[model samples]
Target: MERLVDYLAPRGPLDWVLKTALFIAAINGLNLTVEFAMNGALSMSLLAHVQTTSMVAFPFTLFALSIIRHQHRLQGQLKHLATTDMLTGLPNRRELLRRLGEERRSFGAFILLDIDHFKRINDRHGHAVGDTCLVRCAAHLSGSVGPGDVVARYGGEEFAVLARTRDPAALEALTTRLCEPFTCTVAVEGLTVPMTLSAGVVRADADLGYAELLRDADAALYHAKDTGRNRAVFAPGRPAA
Candidate 1:
């Protein structure tokens, strides 16, 4: 009984319509079988009845197509939700890695950026202001990237950018361009604070692979922090061809 109820349960208006249409089709088929058994042939009146019954089919077809379209739209929404970070509205780690794998063959650059003194911001002004600061920085970073470039929140206060280019000179110039905009400060929740970030860059290449690229970028980020805040550093290695 429970299984029967589950089978009959309506998912939505379209679902109800589809189920009702199928039931009607089944009933019509059964009636036609009974008539054929009694008369050994379908009379003209019975044929007309079947044709009249099939009039419902046009609407049922439209309903079924609409249900399929709605399902596809729902799947797309689910995919987007799974790939997006809610806090900063940037791509989440999973999405970032997916893009990285897709763009692996194409020589590109990965930049790891962290807000300078992020913990200090959270400690001084509390977590609310820290959240605001993160959102602001993410917005800035997203706006700075070129079309087809990716900016993702890599958990905590760190974000990563995937810039599609191989040339060290071009990547370096793009990195510099990205870094230049954060010179301004953010005003959030009655607190005015500088949005300083230290960035580490690694050029994706055939030799190093992605994990090493991430490690190198992280090391360079720490180097930038150790030397001076609010600067960008590139991992030192064989230049990509």
Candidate 2:
């Protein structure tokens, strides 16, 4: 019974229509049976009344179903807007923080990646090209990161990746993979230009707060940018080699 209610609850108008139909049918059938038992004949007027009630119920049922479907669609769209980056289609900062809180206990690594000289690109090529670079960088990060990794846009050209693996080697390798030059063909003056990225990786431990992890990664990223662009830096406390 509970399962039936659960199923019917979601159906909204369709369920109402079905219940109304069944109710009208039951009442009409019962009335006809009583009439035949009492007067030895069934009445056509009783059947007509049931049909009229069914006709009246149809429009209300359809309206209810339409409302439910519209609500379901709206909820889906709202969820997407809340969680997804509008520019790059990656998970946004809010979703990233939510994942960090949820997976901090289980994950061992947090990486913060930023596009090196992103402002230069925007200044030289325009915001349209800058947006293209961001989108391409997001794709590269998504592809380079391992399965079950949480990748998110941390605002502007910066991105965050949370990985669960305990192996520092694996994390470093992933960082190296992301730093490789990305070639995006931007339509600038009827010509195309390429892009590159730099990344910083930090290992998460019980001693570190999520903010501290981000800071560490940001520090490494700053180092990477300061020394040279298109490089990966691992946070201190990992081996020098």
Candidate 3:
């Protein structure tokens, strides 16, 4: 019974279509059965009625299929929303942490990036402009990073990137690539403004926990923001607090 219920529960558009086809076939078969019982012979009138009913039911079957297809598409979209940042279209903090745990055994680097003086932008131009700046920064980071790299929105004005790589030079190059100047036109009170970012990079080893790597990367990020804006800091031997 459980298996039958599972089979009946809508799996997807194909499942719904198959079920609808079977339902229509069953209805036609029942109609034929009743006709044969009453008339003792197959009649052209009953066959024609069944054909007409099938023709009419075809559109209803397609409509059911369309609804199921739409529902599955919406489910996919909801899953994406749960895992991704709405503003930057990057992975959300939850996903970033999840990936970090998944890749802890492998050789990789964890980078924490934050927009420098982001609050200042909000104070001067307003929150709307600040949001625009974040979105633009996200686009640049997404483009600058490599295919295997994972970029995520860690929080407000903060982002995290994870990449599987062993070479320190390659990691350094990635940090440099992210720090390059990016200009975003943010409309504030009918005027446009620009903003920049600062980042911190830390390589993760087999011995380090994912949380520790995040802490180290965050420290480096704070260091960058403190010394100056729009720079990258690499934490090679820093211990997590």
Candidate 4:
């Protein structure tokens, strides 16, 4: 089957060539074994026969590798499309949730941020300008987070940051950094647009599931939106059972 061939195919260029050579050698050995069994003697013609057959098979081997490589590249692109936001090129909500579930047992902080008056921007400047703002916002958040942390486009005008750390000071530092004013402005159609973010921060307990983590963070985000537009609000920690 095509799937089986793809699964067995080597991923790297050198590996594929090496495997192809080995495969041809294997087939040649089998043919020689069968020939010697019946002919009762090996002839010098065997060497010439192998050289001729290998030369004949080389083109087919290259063609097959080309197909396999194309399929692999396509599969990789599909995976990226599934997990990434097309406009922002950041991880999407689905990918963030997947990571949250995986890190449920680890103590961390979950922060949800929304662009303040994002609809106003869309209405006033059109969706194209709004999209440009979103792209710039994503770039800023992506650059702000630590290497181990994840920043994702949670949905339209909203983003999520998952920081894997137990220290409260570290969490506070991150929230403070996010709450600080964005240093850059989006330039679209010769117009400068300023952006501000409102965020909800929640401590992730080891025993807490991702569902609860999301819920707590959402509630905090609501608090931030309700209290003021450009601020971060911390959700109260879950009481010990």
Best by TM-score: 4
Error of model 3, residue 57, in angstroms: 12
**What pairs collide in candidate 1?**
none
TM-score of 1: 0.72
Please give, for residues 9-81, the per-residue lDDT of candidate 3 as tens digits. Answer: 4676777768888867876888778878998887677668778879987788667656655666666687798
Model 1 bad stretches (over 4 Å)? 1-54, 181-188, 237-241
Candidate 3 versus the native: TM-score? Answer: 0.69
In model 4, the clashing pairs are none
- How do the residues 63-170 of candidate 2 rate in per-residue lDDT, one tens digit apiece? 654565566666668889999999999999999998888778788788887887888888998988888878878888899888888889999889988887778677
Better of 2 and 3 by lDDT: 3
lDDT of 1 by residue, 141-228 (tens): 8888877788999989999999887777778777766666453344535557777777888877747776888799888888878877
Cα error, candidate 4, residue 101 (Å): 2.1
The candidate that wins on lDDT is 4
Local distance difference test, per candidate? Answer: 0.77, 0.75, 0.77, 0.80
Reference-based TM-score of each model: 0.72, 0.72, 0.69, 0.82
Off by over 4 Å in 2: 1-62, 237-241
Better of 1 and 3 by TM-score: 1
